[model samples]
Target: MAILSPRRRRSTALTVAAVAGATAAGVCLAVGSASAGTISGPLYRDPSSAVVRWVAANPGDSRAAVIRDKIASQPQARWFANFNISTAQSEAAAYVGAANAAQQIPVLSVYQITNRDCGGASAGGAPDLNQYQTWVSNFSRGLGNQTVIIILETDSLALLTCLNSNEINARNQAISTATRTIKSANPNAKVYLDAGHSTWNSANETANRLRAAGVQYADGFFSNVSNYNSTSSEANFGRAVISALNGMGLSGKRQVIDTSRNGGASGDWCGDDNTDRRIGMYPTTNTGDSNIDAYLWVKPPGEADGCRYTAGSFQPDLAYSLANGVPNPPTTAPPTTAPPTTAPPTTAPPTTAPPTTAPPTTAPPTTAPPTTPPPTGNGCSASVAVNQWNGGFTASVTVTAGSAAINGWTVTITLPSGAAVTGVWNAQASGTSGTVRYTNVGYNGRVGAGQSTNFGFQGTGTGPSTASCAAS
Candidate 1:
C-alpha cells in the first residue's frame, strides 16, 4: 500500500477564502454578508520559498525561467510539520509576521502528530502526545490574531490502520485537543483537518475519524494535500464526507482542497516520483462554491516526495516537468522515463526558516497567459504578461532598457475597464483601478544597457494584455 511522504523543506503560502460557507449537506451558508469572500484576494507569497530561492540562485539554470514564473511567483503553504519545539513559536511568528505585513492570509500545515503516517516514509513526529500538545500550544502563540488557515495533521485521521484500537483513540484525542488549542489562541484561525483524498478511506470512515479528532471545534476539513487526485473527485468526496458528518449530527462545516498537485491524474501517494502530476490552481480564496472555502497550494511545488529524491527537497527537473504540464487537461500519464530508484529519506525538515525582509519582486512566467508584443517607446520596451483563473489574475510587467543605460524609467498601463489592482510589488504605482503609472522604486531605478527589471500585481477582472515602456 502507498503511504504519504508529504514532507516539505520550508514554508510560505497563499489561500482563497470564499464568502460562502457550507453545511453538512453541502448547502451554502452566509459567512459575513453575501458579497464578502466572493472575490479572490491577495495571499502572502514567501519570497524565500524553496522554488524562489532556487530560481534566484540559479537564474542561469536551464529551468529557471519556467520555475520562476510558474512556481516562485505564486503563494504556497509553509509547513510547520517538523519537530522543532523550542523554536516552533518563534518560527511560526516570523512566517506569520511576514504574511501579516503583506496583509495576506497565510496557509500552514501542522503535521507533527505522534506516529504520523504510521512510520511510513513521512514519519517521526513528537516523542509523545504530551510534548506534541505542548508544541501545539507554543505554535499557536505565534499566530497573533491574524486570519490564518491551517491544515491540521495531514495523516493523523486518515492513515490510522497501522494503529491498534487504543493507539487510534489516543491519536484522535491528541488531534482534538490540538485543534482547540490553535483556534483558542487566534479566533481568526480556520483549522481544517485532513480527510485523506477521494481514493482513500470511505466517507463514513473518514467522517467517524474526523469526529473523534474534534471536527466540531474546527472550521472544517481538507483533502489531497500532497496527492494528485483531480479537483472534481476531491470535491465530490468532500461532499460525501460532509454528508456523513451531518448524519452524525456535526453540521455547518466547510472544507478546503489542496490543488497544488491535482492538475493531472492522481498518482501514487507513497512514492518518490512526482513527475506524473502537474501544478493545479494557484492559491486563492475565491472558490466559486460556498462549501469550498478555498483552493490552496498545501504542498509547495518542486519538492520531492521521497521516492526518487530526498523527501521535501526541491528538484528543478521535477519542477520543470510539473510547471511545463500546467492547465494540464486530465489525462492518462504519458509513456515516459521509468521512475528512478526509490530511497528512504536521510533527513526531512517540514519547514524552512522565514524571510526577514521584503521578498524580491518576481519575473513573468514564460508560459500560460500569452504575452503581448512588446511595444517600444522612449528608449525602452515592456511586456504585460499574465496568469488568470476565474475572477482574478496576476500580471508581471518587465521593462528593459534600450542599448544605452537608463538612469530611471516609468511605464504606463491601461488596464481593461473594471480591473482593480489589489497589490503591487517590486515597483511603485500611481493608479489602483484604471490607467496606472509605474515607476522604478529606489533600488531598482537603474538598469544596465539592455538589462531588464520587472514588477507584478494581483487584481480582479480582466488583466491587460499589452504594455508600453517609457524610460530616460
Candidate 2:
C-alpha cells in the first residue's frame, strides 16, 4: 500500500475543508414525508457480512440482540470494492442475483480510486487507472437487469487536492469511464457519485469536481458515506451540490444521504467515543426531498472508521453503542387503535377484473395502499396493506383484538405465488408462499381489545396482492 506522511494527509483534509467553507450550505430540507416503502428499494442482504456472522455465531449473546435489531436486521450494501479483482465479476453477479431473487435492490460501492484515501486510514486501491477501469467494467457487467444502486468511489471528489493535476485528470477519466460502462451494461441501474458529506467539502467545489468526472450520465451523487453527519445537514449539502451541478447544465440529478450512523449526535465526528455515534434513520425512500432520493446506510453501523479499532473492522462495542444509543422510532410502538384495515375475505380476495362500481355493502378494491376492511367476525382479525414498487412490495399486517386482549398471536397469511419474504420487522415471520406465518416477538405480544400491533414484511412481486389472513 502506498503511504503518505501525516503532514500530507492533514494538508489534504485541510484543503478540502477550505473549499467547503465557500460553498456547501443554504439548501432547505423538505418537510414532505417519503412515500412509505423500504428505502433504496430493498437493500441486498449479504450473509457473509461481518454483522451477520456475529449474529449467527452468538445468537444468545445480549450484544448480538442489539446488533441484530440495529444493524444485521436492516438490508444494507454488499461491498465488492475491495475484494479480489479476479473473482469480482462472479462475486458481484452472485450478490446481484441474490438481491433479484429477494426482489430487492442491491447497493454496490465502487471504491478503488487510483490512490484512494490519499494514503490515509483506508489507503489501498487498484494499482492504476487502467486496472481500475477493467475492474469496474467487470463489476458492471454482473448487474444483469436487476435494479441496483452504484455508489462510485467514496472520497474521490472530496479528496482531490491530494493528487497532482495529472492524477486528478486520470482519476476523473477513470470515474467517467466507469460510469459509462456501468450504465451501458445495465440501463436500469442507478449510479451515484460520492460527494463526501456536508462537513468535508463545499457544495460548489464538489459539484465542480463531479462535473469534471462526468456525473450527468449517472443518476446523481451520495453524501455522508461512513461519516456521522446528521441527515438534515447532509440533505442540505446534497441540495447545494445538486443545485451547483444544475447551474452547470446538469439538471435532474438527485442524491442519497448516508444515514447509517448520526443518531442525532451533532459534533466530534472523529472521536473515539463509540456512543457518540448511533444508528440513524432506518433506510427509507421517504426522505421528503425532491432532490434527495433516499436515506441509506451506505456505511453499515458497527464497522469502525480507523479509531476505536482498525478501520473497516466490525467492532462489537461500537455496534452496541449504535444499537442502544438511540431509542427505537416511535412508530415501532404498537398502535393504540387498529389502523383502518382492509380485511380481505377468509379466502383469497378476487384477483379477477374489478367492476367499475362497488356492490352494495362491499368496499372498493384498493391498490398501492390496501384499505378494504377485512371480514371481522373472529375475536382476532388481521388487515394487510401494501406499498409496492417495480418488482417488490412492503406488506404491513395489523392484527387487532375484538372481544378480549390477546396475550400471544399468530397470524398466517398466504403470499402471492412466486413471491418470497425478504425481510420482516416487529415479528418472527416464517414459511414461504401459500401459508406464511408471523408470530409476535416479546415486545409486541400483548394487544388489548380494540388495540392493534403492527408488523411488516418485504417480498418479491409485481404488485400487492390480496392475501387471506387468520389471527389466532
Candidate 3:
C-alpha cells in the first residue's frame, strides 16, 4: 500500500501508561500503553506512529479506549516510502538503530519510485533514477547487520503495463539497480519486491513483471500490501508467482503476505467499513506454506485507505470499529516471539527446478488423449479446459454433482509437467509440482442434486488436457 502522511487536523488523549493499563478481552496488555503484542515475531513497533500520537492527544474521546486497545496495540510496518530525501538517512538510521537496540527486526515498506501511484493520492516519488539510487543507497546504509525486511515499492509490479517501452525499461533498470545495491550493502537484509494483490494482477502477469524487475536478486515478492483480500487467496497468489518464478530460474525464492485488516468480510476492498475488517492471522513466520515466509501487518490498521479521512491518517472511529467489530485472538496469544535469525521455509524446499523461460504463449493443445469416463452413480464429474499464453495459463474446472446432493467435494488434477497452480478462488487448495487439489470452502461447499460449481486457477504450464474427478 502507498504510505503518505497527509496534513490532517489533530485531536487531543490519555497517558501511554493509562492506555496500556486499560484492558479489553482480546486487547494486548503489554507494559507499554501501545502494542497489541499478538504477533509471535519481533516486528519493530514505531514509538511515534500516528496512532500513538492520536491516542496520546485524545484519550478522553469516546473511541479512545478501543482505538488504543486495537490500533496502537498492534505491531505494524514503518513506511519510509516518502520522497523526503533531505533527512531520509537520519530517519532510516534512527529507526534501524532503535530496532537494533530493542532486539527486533524492523519491517520497512520502501516506496520511492520515479512515478509513484500514477498521479493518484500517493503520486509523488523520486524525480528520476539518480535520486532513487541515492535514496536507496541511504536507505541501505541503515542495515548494519540488523535484520530488516525491505518491502520494495507497492505498485512496482502491477504498474509496469501502464508505462511505454522506455519507461518500462527504465523502471526495470532502477529496480534491478536498487535490488543489487541493497544486497551489496547488507547481504543479511531480506528484500521483497511488491507484486500488488491477488485481485489486481494474475500470478502469471505479476511473475513476469517481477522477473523483469530483478526479483531474482531479492528474497521474494510481497502481496496484499494495501488491500483486504483473504489470507488463502494471497497465499495461493504467492504460490503461483513463486511457481512461475521458479520456471523462470528464480528457484528457492520466498513470499510474505500482508494480513493486517483482512480478518473480516473482505468483500469490496474500497467499500468495506472498519467494522467489516478485523486483524487477520497474527504476525508469525509459521505461515503454513513452505514458500510463504510471514503474514505481516504491512498496512497499519486504523490508517484511512484514502476513502474515509485523507489517506494514511489514523482515525479513532475507524480504529475503534476495527478493534471492537470482530473477534481477534486474545493479546495473551504469544506476547512477542523474536523474528527468525535465518529466513526459514515453512515446508521442505521445492524439488523441481525447471527451465526459466516459459514456452511461447499460445492457444491450448488442439487435442486431448482419450481417457476412461468418470465413474457414474457416485454423483460427481469433473471437466477441465485450459487457455494459455506465453509462460502461463488459466485453468477452469467445472464440477457437476450427479444425482444426489453432496456435503463436500474435492477435485484433484495432475498439472502438465512444468505447470504449477499459483492462485485459486471460489475454493481452498493445496498441492505439489505435479498434482493439485481444490476443496469447497464454507459458502460454496454443498452442491444440490444435478447442480454444479465452477472454480478456476492461474498457473504456469502448457496444458492439463484432462483431469479425473471423484465424489462420495
- How accurate locally, in lDDT, is each candidate? 0.64, 0.59, 0.61
Residue 38 alpha-carbon offset, candidate 3, angstroms: 20
lDDT of 3: 0.61
Which candidate wins on TM-score?
Answer: 3
Error of 1 at 412 (Å): 67
Residues 1-472, model 1: lDDT tens digits: 1123221122222122211211112112111111112223456677667776677677678877777666776677887767878878887888899789977778888877887544534456798999999999999999989788888977567655446789888988888999999999998898998786665567888898889889999988987676555576677778899999999999988778887755653222222443455777666665555667777888787776544566677888888877884643212212222112233211111111001110111111223332343333437777766544345555656677777777788888899988887656556789788889888766456776766655666567777887777875
Q: TM-score of model 3 relative to the true fold? A: 0.63
List runs of model 3 lying over 4 Å from the truth: 1-41, 266-268, 271-275, 328-472
lDDT of 3 by residue, 1-472 (tens): 4311111100111111223423232345222221222123456665667777677777678887677666676667887766766666777777778778877677887777876644434556698889999989887886777567888877666644235689888999899899999899888788889676665567888888999899889888887665555677677767788899889888978888887766664221221233555666666554545677667778777766554455566767777766776554454434333334244323211100011211111111122312234344656777765545445655556676777777778888888788876655556678745878778666556666676555556566565766655664
Each prediction's Cα RMSD?
Answer: 22.7, 23.8, 12.6
**Any idea how many clashes model 2 has?**
6
What TM-score fits each model? 0.62, 0.61, 0.63
Which 10 residues in a row give candidate 3 its minimum summed lDDT? 5-14
For candidate 1, the TM-score is 0.62
